[model samples]
Target: MNQTYTIKEKTKQIFVLLIPILITQLGMFSMVFFNTIMSGKYNSSDLAGVAIGSSIWSPIFNGISGILLAVSPIAAQRFGEKKSNEVSAVVRHGIYLSVFIALAVIILGFFFLNPILNKMALPARVEKTAFDYLVGLSFGLLPLFIFNVLRSFIYALGKTRVVMVIMLMSLPVNFFLNYAFIFGKFGLPELGGAGAGFATSITYWIIMGMTWFIVKTQDPFSSYPVFANMREFSWEKCKEILQIGVPMGLSTFFETSMFAVVTILLSKYSVTTIAAYQSALNIVSFLYMIPISISTALTVLVGYEVGARHYKDAKQYSWLGVLLAILIATGTGVLVVIFRYQVAGLYSNETAVINLTANFLIFALFFQISDAIQATAQAALRGYKDVNLAFIMTLIAYWLICLPVGYLLAHFAGLGARGYWLGLTIGLLAAGIALSIRLIYIQKRKFTHIQVKEVV
Candidate 1:
């Protein structure tokens, strides 16, 4: 990157990074999207089961992946520093750390899954389906975590299109597997909602294999020698990753688990309620990828500039990325409002489910606006390595504010799912405003430090 860039130049760079990441994000999310749609079609019970199962696992998956996400910015900064050896070492270590984290999740999962489900007290059929789904899904955790490490490393190197290609390649395979396994096709036994988990696991392994193969044989990555000539684990290097990663992972967990908690709480309502919420959530999550993709790009762009001591360039990327995200979100949010009913109908044919989902999307507008701003700002903060504070703020926002307010409104106020969304909107608004203000303060402090050093 140049020492400085114009608005047009920065926008172009952000777009270049954003588009492929967007496609990859969508492709990855569509796996769950397909699962929800297919499960809903099969039966409301199946849909509710999948919804419950997804609520339990998505947070875990994302929190772990969020830790792995640190590899991107870490690698990006090193790449910006032009330290090839450091970059390669971090990538290899990231792969190792993934296994360690995955193992912990597996062990804890064995001890905790049953207890958590029992606490939720879902209907018998739904509980069984959720349990079976998670158990089947468990088989692919190791490969999934490993793939995420490679993905972060590669994306940090600006090889996003490579990941996009591999994700797209896996989509068809996932679709086929879901079809075959869910319906007992091709001699596979029918597993109903649980099959989606197994299908997704198989897909995870396939994509991981593809990514590993590409990284091993590809042009520049081939030289990284990520897999070959392994070196002894460095405690210091691992600490460096953990120091940056843990807070990030917790922040993600706080945000995602808030929603997961809401899902479990909603289990007390009818199956239609659970299915409708999940359906609407899938759309919300799909649209969220728009901003989150920009956020990921900002991490790479800003981290690169920060690493190169170009604070101004990093600031430029930060503002521009957030601006781009808000613009797109505004447009999409409006469109969702305009077509809420039509969009809701896409998820289910039941009139009650459709009506409730449509209303949820109305509340979703506020949620998306706040979320788009905050998500971008949060990602930019990560680029600046300003994670610890962000984590604390996020916990307060989601747990102390969001869940409490949401629970009261949902149960006490009798607003049902809409009440929870209202609480979420308020929480995201708080987080977005706080984080955006902090980003500006960080930029100013950085420049002030630079000036002070010059005088000294």
Candidate 2:
């Protein structure tokens, strides 16, 4: 009875944390979704441009966000150990790290902008629109990175609701701004695809400002005094963050870059192909929010348990998270399969685009299971501070195996876009199996250590 009750309590806690994180993620992605839908309605070329711009920018942005995510587990562990003061130092260092990375991305964007586009050899119009979109979007990198730092800090402290509320507020603001700028409303000239970028940049700044205002005024964050050490910079702390974060960032880069590469490859086909791919990808990404949210909460929970030296509890949390993720994926995959056509139709009205997108959704069903398992297991491993192994595995699985297979099947075998997704399915399966095994091995090793200590 006692064990059952404890499990029930833990499950409830996970849900409480997971729900808000899930909503927050959906809110974040909605900005992109709105841009995609609005752009699709505006013009197919613009849609392709948005797709290309998103593929290029998202990986860079997400990679940096992943690096800052190291703050979450680190802060969670410290908080669990009752080392509250240390959390502030972590936040400060995280801010410095965010600034550095944002500047690096901006510099790279400026230098490589045209050369990279020329290499792709995209349709001249698509290429021009994508270039303009990226230029407008680049302005938001600083605020976006800073917002991520604050989000990681707050999420680690288990105050996810605050971030969720802020993200929710940004959704309408983003929509309104996109409508105004994209259509030449409110005395603004129509900028077509570039308008989406401008709206996104402005929305990010608003969200950042609102988030800062809340952190400054909120009672929940008063105890940490996160701003108290703003001027203090510690090399050791920065190094510590990078040690964990670099691998995490690389892991994210490897995965997102694989998709970006696929997008680039598809761009060689036609506007219709790219638009269909974008629509399907959007649906898959929406379903992905569930597992990713659960995984994030698991990271904090597992880290807290590990820091408290409750290895058994930590292991339980990890497995529970994986189980929950798979179950949720199973349900979502079923619904997506059932309503695949309807979902595709939501993104675009073109018959060719809708038909192709619907077909891709079938493959998405199988990969969803693999994706959930790998994501949750990776998060658990991060909680154990076992980060590098996953990164190496992902690099091997996605780059060495998946991308090569995808290219061969798409170009050589004449399977086209479908071939790339097939390759992704196989890669996700490999990653899921490898990461799950790693988590099991780590847990068993820790359990053995506890046994040896007990005997001694």
Would you list the C-alpha lDDT of every candidate in the order shown? 0.87, 0.85
lDDT of 2 by residue, 1-456 (tens): 011126777788788889999999989888988887787777789889988888778887778888999998888888777787888888888889888888998898889988998998899889988998898888888888889888888888778888999999899999988888788899997988878999999999999899878777786676777778578889999998898888998898889888878887888988998999988887888789999999989998888777766677778889999999999999999999899889999989899999899999998988899889989999999888889888998888899878888888888898998888888888888998999999999998764345112332
Cα distance off (Å), candidate 1, residue 311: 1.2
Candidate 1 lDDT over 113-186, as tens digits, reads 99999998799988888888888888889899889889888877876889999999999999999888788899
Off by over 4 Å in 2: 1-5, 39-46, 122-125, 264-278, 344-359, 406-419, 447-456
| Pairs with steric clashes in candidate 2 | none
Q: What is the lDDT of residue 384 in candidate 1?
A: 86
Best by TM-score: 1
- lDDT of model 1 at residue 47? 88
Best by lDDT: 1
Q: What is the lDDT of residue 158 in candidate 1?
A: 77
How many Å off is the CA of 79 in candidate 2? 0.7
lDDT accuracy of residue 117 in candidate 1:
94
> Candidate 1 regions off by >4 Å?
1-4, 37-47, 122-125, 187-190, 264-279, 348-356, 407-417, 447-456
